[model samples]
Target: MGSLAFFIASLGFLLPLVSNANPLDKRAAALKPFNLRVTFKPAAYAVPSTIQHVQDAVACGASNGVTVTAKSGGHSYGSHGLGGEDGHLIIDMRNFSNVTVDQTAQTANIGPGGRLGNVATALYNQGKQAISHGTCPGVGVGGLTLHGGYGLSSRGRGLTLDNVLEATVVLANSTVVTASTTQNPDLFWALRGAGAAFGVVTNFKFKTFTAPENNIVFQYFFSPSSASQLATALTALQDFTRNSQPPELNMRLFLSSFTTFSGVYYGSRSDFDKIMNPLLSKMGIGSGTVSTNSWLNTLTSFSNGPLAQTGTYDTHETFFSKSLMPEYMSPEAITALSNYWNANARSNSRQWYLLFDCHGGNGSAITKVSADSTSYAHRNATFKMQFYDRVASGNYDPSWMPFLNGWVKSITDAMPSVNFGMYINYADTSLTKDEAHTHYWKDNYKKLVDVKMQYDPKRVFEGPQIVGS
Candidate 1:
């Protein structure tokens, strides 16, 4: 039997067959909410073990006139998985995880509850295959794909949404439907990028690729003892982004107590060296490390070393993140970032960092997909930058949040010469509805609104900064 069929067949043996009694009412006290950042207590929480369970939960919520929020990986930076308000029903999709790969077809049917780590490991075990996904392993495949997932392989392979062949979604009226290129084409287009506003996705059919034999990971740490050194490094980075970037290369810049340039080159070591040596020489970076490893190990290194989220899907950490897409990075913008970091180096009560993720290359598949093809409107962006702050749940002080927000604003305000748009995945609850619409959707906002009107006219699945909200 297929994996989904087996799961349904075994559900009777795994869970007790309950009648019309609500599962949420039976398991409410034992429920552990995913995010600690959001203080709202849900009216009830349902952990669906099967598709039927999901349908029942939706029907129950609809009957009671309570909003339903679906929690897949539970890693929403703004805690949008929790509905951003009190007294809503939350559908926890963790139990529904099951991955089945068809080697001949080079495709995998991934359950909504599957994490990137589980999916990667499964595909690797089957036939040394893999899918493009975010750095963190604990993030849900459903949520990531819904927000147009990007990662190290994105430039060459394309975003996660680009790989999706089909999706089984439970609509607002509790009707299950399959969305793909031929069936429900308009809904498929909207679901690729702005799916959260439409319905709950139960399964994703994704096109997979053969994993690369070897991968190169490199990192350069620059303390910049003097202003000249810092300027040289920053300028070299800007030049590299503008002039010499390979489609196989994915680069990221970090500005915290110091500046670090890190990236993965999905190719042989010699090829990576050929592309990176000149940039290193120009920037005067002599002490960085570059290592080559198998594809799985490379993903492991990124997760354990850079991402720092080593736990399973249930792992929860309190964090706040805001993102912006800048057309280009000017020297003045670099200076502004340095000044902000230096000014607040000691005043920060929690760990904080800035990330500059280089996006497009000359042959980037990300840019090959037209801007109007999907709701992800920032296809032409040079870099997507994020301001991140990590705080313990108990140590989270509301006063400190404003300082972090203000610092990000100051840095963004400094770059008047560039146009800025925000990433929808790194959602910011502070943005007004109009601001969110303009920044996240940009030119595609009107089309997304029309789709929302057609599919979810009543707005059953609503969260902060959601498409129709």
Candidate 2:
């Protein structure tokens, strides 16, 4: 029998008692993801509060031969946490929020449902500890860690997945297992980069670093008269990051209201100035606003609201985003991208922006690890670029896709030397399954497929872009 037909046929046997199953009529109306572009209705919903409750939900899905997925912060750009498409059992994991620290060992046991903001606060308050994670406060630990977590601290400390030591997972068979370097080594390797495809991770143990002190936040804005000037500014920044950029210095180029460069340096003002003087001189820009602050305050400054996703996941956006992990862009590519943005952005009413996050350099911790050590394959990426566009506040227009796609093409068409890869966290729904595999996993795709076959032979943990789906 076919997969869908067999799943339906096998439901006649035993109906396990999974708690808090919303009625079919009500399930469709509730539960919205961060992105409103895709509307989904799961076949059922299970709001589990404990590990046993999670296990029972998995058991129920196994008995009924239904696919299952877990929702932590529900911040997926494609809404994949809500089964990506629909008709699968959804496990709401928001109730498992907890961040417990072991100060003696400098390790933290974080619940999968914990958001990045809350995790940051708890770690700082308890032991003045922290882990490399994203800037967005509402992003969940599960999705960020499973994919690849990049933040201002990533270049200094490494990606969040690099800090993960172990995980407690409930498998497709409803059996609990501990995955680590010493136990279930294969599962551990896969979970670091592709955790969502193998099982429902209940908890994560991460090795923490002592929070950096005296963070210096800086911002510079430029209004270039021509596209070539903008390209010159970008090229200067790229050359600065080419090699031996200090680990303590992090910078991001923003293509927004004005061509802007902003970031946090995890060091003193004198040291930050020393490191930045040459770059500032190259671009002929005066010293921008630079100030010193504590580590916790620095985190607060980067977020929109309080660093907690407690009561409800209210932050929502109707937007489309695409990412690229490319080597340094040539002057021709930057000029082409600048000209396109200058020509079209003023005529369009849609809100759009782009961010280029510095990643690879001799001093960066992200590239220090071996490429084969984990499933994440983009160790050589010089930087990751995120392109986002959205309607003001309503349902997204299908016709707007071409504008964003064209913006990306302006860069790729002008440059042929840069081998670009896409970041899975900023997933684009337009790509086919094969394209997704090639851009996201690259050489690691085959290993991820093998792990999926071993752990989830029936494709129980499924989504539209899920491995082996």
**What is candidate 2's lDDT per residue for 253-288, written digit by digit as tens?**
877766678889987788888888888877667746
Candidate 2's error at 317, in angstroms?
A: 0.7
Cα lDDT listed for each candidate: 0.75, 0.81
Q: How many residue pairs clash in each candidate?
A: 0, 0
Error of 2 at 153 (Å): 0.8
So what's the TM-score on candidate 1?
0.88
TM-score of each: 0.88, 0.92
Encode model 1's per-residue lDDT on 337-420: one tens digit a residue. Answer: 666665674357577777887776455677778888778878877777778777765645566677667766766778865557
RMSD of 1: 5.5
Residue 259 local lDDT, model 2? 65
